[model samples]
Target chain A: MTDHIDQDRPGRGDGAAGDAHRAKPTSSAFEIILPALGERPAFEVGEAVSVRDRSPIGHYRVPIYLRGHVGTVVRIIEPVLVDNEAEGYGRNAGSRLHYYRVAFPLTELWSRYEGAPGDELHVEIFETWLERAQ
Target chain B: MTSVHTDHHDHDHDHAAIEQVDRPGYYEVMETAIRELLIAKGLISAGDIRHQIEVLDSRSPALGAAVVARAWTDPDFKRRLLADGRKGCEELGISFYDDTQLIVLENTSEVHNLIVCTLCSCYPRPVLGLPPDWYKLKPYRARAVSEPRKVLAEFGTHLPDDVEIRVSDSTAAVRYLVLPLRPEGTDDWSPDELAAIVTRDAMIGVIPVTIGGEAA
Candidate 1:
C-alpha cells in the first residue's frame, strides 16, 4: 500500500522544478564538506550503499536517473563544505563530507550499449544514495 | 532505374524491421516506472507528467525564437544582452533567477563560452527549456570542461586558435546558459519571423544561429 503512494505524484523526476519544491525551507546548522582528495576511504568494489532521503532541502545530485541502477565505486574525490540536502530545513545549518566519484558500466546502464569493457561512464554523485552492494 | 537489385529490398526491409524493435534503455524504463508509480500513488497525475514533458519539448524552440526576435528588432536589447544576459532576458519577460541564480554568458568573436555541469546535468530549463539527450551524456559533460575546444570541434564548432574558450561549470546551486550571437542578414525581419530559426542547440552555444536554418 505504501508503494502505491510513491507512484501518484506529479513531476517525480528531479530537475529545476522539482528542486524548487524540495529546497530546504531554511538553512541548516551544520556545514557540509566534500571529502578531501588522496584520503582513501574504504569501500569494496561492489558494495551496496544506501542513499539518504533528501526530500526536505530539495536539490540533490543523485538524480532519479540512477535510483535503482547499481554501479561500482570508481574514484574518491576531495571533500568541500556545502549544505546538507537531508537536513536542509528552515533555519537548520550543518555541513557534511561526501564522496564524489563512481563508475557505472555503460552496458549496465544501457543494455544495448556495444562499447568495449573499458568504456565506462564516470558520474560524480553525492554519497547519500549509495549503500553496500549485496 | 534499378535493373538488378533483387536482394536489396529484403535487406532494407530487414534493417527497418530490426530498427523498429530496438528496445528502450534502462533509464527509459526506469523513467516510465517512476512516472507510473507517482501517478498511482497520487503524488501527481499522469496528465501532469505528460504536461511537463510537453512543456520541455516545446520550451527550447520557444526560447530560441524569443532571443532571435529580440536580436533582430532591438539594437539596445542586443547590446544589453551582450553586456548582461540575465538582465537582457528579463526585459523580454524571460525569468532566469527565481529558484536558482542563473548566469548568462555571451559568445562573441573574441571569447566563446560553453556550459556543462560535470557533476550533474544542471541547466536553466526555465529560460532555454529542457536539455537535449546529448547534452546530458557523460562524454559531453566530461569533455566540455577539460577539452572544450576539441569537444566543440566534434559538434562542428571550431573556434580559431586566437579565440578564447570559456567553459562554465554548473553546480547544485548555480547554473549557466549561453546566449548565442545574433545571425547576420536579419536586419529587417520581424521578431516572430526571426524566432522561427532559433534552435535550442544554438542557444546552448553548441551551434550558431544560421540565417538560413539549422546548421548542416
Candidate 2:
C-alpha cells in the first residue's frame, strides 16, 4: 500500500499552511526507544507466564484490565525502560523493564466469553508482573 | 451420623458469620481513604471536591453535539480540522487541556484507525467525557492492536474486509481521537440538523455518521 506523506505546505492542496508551520522534527527519546524496544526476540505462543499487580502512579500505561489476569508468554520484545511508578512517588528512582506481546486465553479472562477456545488476547506487560507460569 | 450432621451445621453457620463480618463497601472505603489522605495533606477542601463532582455530573452532551454539527456544515472548517484538530476545535469555542496534545485520526477507504491505551485507559476526557466500561477491559486493549476489526465488530461496527485496520496506542506523550467520515444525504440540512446525527461514537471513529439513512 502506498503511504501518502501529506506535505504540511499551504496552498498545495488546502489553503491552510498552519500544519507546515507547526511541523517540528520528531526526535523525542520516546520515539527513539520505541523502535528499539519493539524489535525484541520472539517467543513461542502458549508458554505460561505469571502476571502480578503493579504499583499505582498518577498516570500509568498498565490498564486495570490485566491487573490479575494470568496469561501465556507469547513473544519477548526488546527491553525498554519507563518511569517507575513507585519511584515517581518519591520512593526509589529507576526505570522499569517491560516486554511486549503476552497472550491470554479469552476463557481465562471471562467465563462467559463465547469465542473459540483457542482465541487469545495478546498484550504487552512489564517485567515486574511476570514470572514463569506453572 | 446424627452427631456428625450437627457438627457440620454449626461449622457452616460459623463460616457464614465470618463471611458476613462488616467491612466498608469498596466504593465507600476507597472514597473515605482518598478523602482522608487529601484532607490530611490539605490538598483540597471537601467542598471543592464535592463541587467538582457536581460539575462533572451535570455536564450535558450538548457541547460535543455542537462541535460535531459545526464541522459537518463548514468545508473550510473541516479542512482546518484535518490539519489541526485542537486549533479547529478551539475555533468552535471548545477548549480542551492546554497541557496535553490531542491527535485526530481520519478514516478513509484504505485504512481505519482505532485508539486504545493497552496499558491503561487514556481518553480525551475533556472533549469526550467519561469512557465506556468496555474501553477499560484488557480484552479490548490486547485485541485492539492484534485484531482491531474483531474488537470493533463487538461494538456492532463492521468495515470492508480489505481495509487495513490501524490501531493507535496512546501513551503519556500523545493521545488520539478518531474523526469518522461524513455521512451521505442531507445535503440541504442545516448545521444544527447535521450535528444531531454526529454522535460521540462517530467522533471517536467507532461508527460512521449516517445522513438520511445514507453512509457518510
Candidate 3:
C-alpha cells in the first residue's frame, strides 16, 4: 500500500537506520554534566533480563504487572539520567541510570492474551529494576 | 465593594452557550484548592499560572506532524529521527520543554507500534502537547499493554493477523512517539500537505494516517 513511499531509501526498517545515526542521541554533540550519579550502563541491547520483583513505597514508575516477568533489552536510552524511583520522591540525590526498552511476549505479560505468538509488549525499565535473566 | 456597571456591553454572538461541568471531579477540586492556596501564600502568581497554561495550549500535534513530514520527505532526516528522536526534532527547530528524552518508534510492514503508559499517562508532550482524556483514564492505561489488539480495533486500527502488535508501556521518564508509516498516494505532496494529513492519533499509534479520513 505504501508503494509511493521511496523504497530505495536506506535505513527504512525498524528505525535503527545505521550506526552513523547512532553516534549520540542527544540535543547536542557534547552534554554538560551537572552531576553524574550512576556508572556506565550495565546491560546491552539484545540481552535477556528480568524485572526485579520488589515493590517500594511512594511514587514509583514501574507498573506492578511487570514486576517478575522476563524480557529482552531491545534498546538502551543514552545519557544516563535520574532514576524515576528516586525522582518521584522529589529528589534524584544519587540514583541515575540508563533506560532499557525491554520487550516481552504479550502472552507472557497476560494469560489468555488474544493475539498471535508474535505479539509483544515493550516497556522502558530502569537499570535498578532489571536483573540478568540469561 | 465592587462597582456595578450601569450599561453592560453584552452582544449576541454565533456561539453556543458556555457550559460548565456538572461538578468538579476529585482532582479538579484539589487543583483549584492547591492553586488558590499557592497564590495566597505568594509563592506563585496567577499570571504565571496563566502563562504556563498558554505555553501548554500553544503546543499541539502540528509540531509532531511537521517532524513526521520532514522524516517522510528526507531519508537522512528519517534515519536521524529513528536513531535519536530528540536530536532529530531539535534539528527541525522544534524545541524541547522537558528535560526527559524522546524516543521515536517506527512502524513497519511486519510490525506495528503502539504507545501506552500503563503506569501513568506519559506522552511526548514537547511535540504533541497534552494527551486526550482517554489516554489518562484507567481502562486505556490498564488494557493497552494487555489487550492492545482489541484496543486498536476499538480505535478503528486493524492490522493483518500476521503483523506484530508491539505495545510500548512507558514506565520511565523517557517518552515515546510512533513514527507512523507515511501513506502511499502523497508521494509528490509538499511537507505542509503531508503534515496536514498526519493526525494526533497517528503519532499515538492508535490509528494510521489515511488520505480520505481516519479509519472507521
Candidate 4:
C-alpha cells in the first residue's frame, strides 16, 4: 500500500499530529496518588477535584487553562498502563494510574464566558494531575 | 494460540481502496524508509503493517450506528451501554484492538454533549471510523474548547437556552462516543431501520438524529 492520500482530506492523517503529545514527557515530577496502585482510587464520582496548578515543561494531556480549576468527578475511568510522563521518554514503567473525568463549569474556565451558566467542560484527567478540592 | 503469530485469514472483506490510494507523501516516504530499514534488520515484517492497515480500514461509523440503534430499541442493552461502554460494545460483537477505553456519553433533554480532541484528534476509531477533516483543524479544536456554543452553532446544532451544553475534550487514552438522544416518534422502528439515520456527525454530537426519513 502507498502512503499517498487525497490532499482534499488534509486533516485525514489519522491523528498522527496528536501522537507527539503522547510521546513527550512532562517536565514536572510525576504526581503521586494516595493508596498508589493496589488500592481504591483517590476520587469518587461527583467528588470535587482541583486540577494541580503546576506547569510542566514537556508533553502532557491536562489542558493548561484548566490547571488550578475545580471540577466534579464524573467517573473513575480505567487504569493507565503507562503513566504519560514516563511514556514521553519511551519508557514503559508498567505503572497503573487512576483516570477520572472531571467536569468544570465553563464560567469558571473562562473569564468572559457567554455560554449557558450551566455549560461545562468534561476532560479525562489522570489522577496525578488532581488534588482534593478544598 | 501458542504459535509465534497466528494468521487471521479474514480476507473476505474488499481491499480495493488499499490498492487505489497508493500515493506516498513525505511522511509516507519517511515511514517506508524506516519500515524498510527495520525489515532489512529483521525487526518487523511488511505483512504485519499491511495486516494492521487492513484491520483499521474495515472499521466504520456503521459499527457504531449499529450499537446506537440496538440501544435505542432495547432498554436492557441501553442500560448496559450507559453503565459500561467497552463491554457493551463487545456484547454487540464490536471490540477494539487498542488499549484506549471507550466511554459513551448520553445526551438528554436537559443536557447536551459535544466531543473534541483539543490536544490532538484522539477519536474513537474502532467504532466511528477516522475523524473527519474538520475535526482535526486547529480552529475547530481551539474554538471547541474555548467557545463550544459558537462552534456548535456553526455545525447547525443550536440547542435551547435552557439545555446545558457540555464539551468533552478527549485529551487522554479514554475515547468518547456521544450517545445522542434518540429522536422522537420512532418507537416502532426496527434496529436496522434506525441505524440508517444514525450519522457519524450525530454520534459525534455535532447534530441530532432526525425523526423522519431524512438521511444524515
lDDT of 4 by residue, B12-70 (tens): 54333323344678998998899999999988888988898888898899999999999
Worst 10 residues of 3 chain B by lDDT: B1-10
Instruction: Please tell me the TM-score of chain B in candidate 3 relative to the true structure's chain B.
Output: 0.85
List model 1 lDDT by residue over A1-134, tens digit each: 63332232332112344344334342543322222332234343344443443443556665544557766664443343243454455432444434544555545655654333333444445554566665
For model 1, the local distance difference test gives: 0.59
CAPRI-style class, candidate 3: medium
Question: lDDT (0-100) at residue B94 of candidate 1?
Answer: 69
Q: Model 4's A-chain: what TM-score? A: 0.67
Q: In order, what is each prediction's RMSD in angstroms?
A: 16.0, 15.3, 11.6, 16.4
Model 3, residue pairs in steric clash: none
Q: Taking the tens digit of each residue's C-alpha lDDT, what string does model 1 give over B24-57?
A: 8999999999988988899999788778677666
Q: Judging by DockQ, tell me the better candidate of 3 and 4.
A: 3
Over 4 Å off, model 4: A1-38, A79-81, B1-30, B212-216
Winner by TM-score: 3
* Candidate 3, superposed: residue stretches over 4 Å from native: A1-37, B1-26, B40-42, B214-216
TM-score of model 3's chain A, to 2 decimals?
Answer: 0.68
lDDT of 2 at B132: 77
**DockQ scores of all models, one per candidate:** 0.04, 0.08, 0.60, 0.54
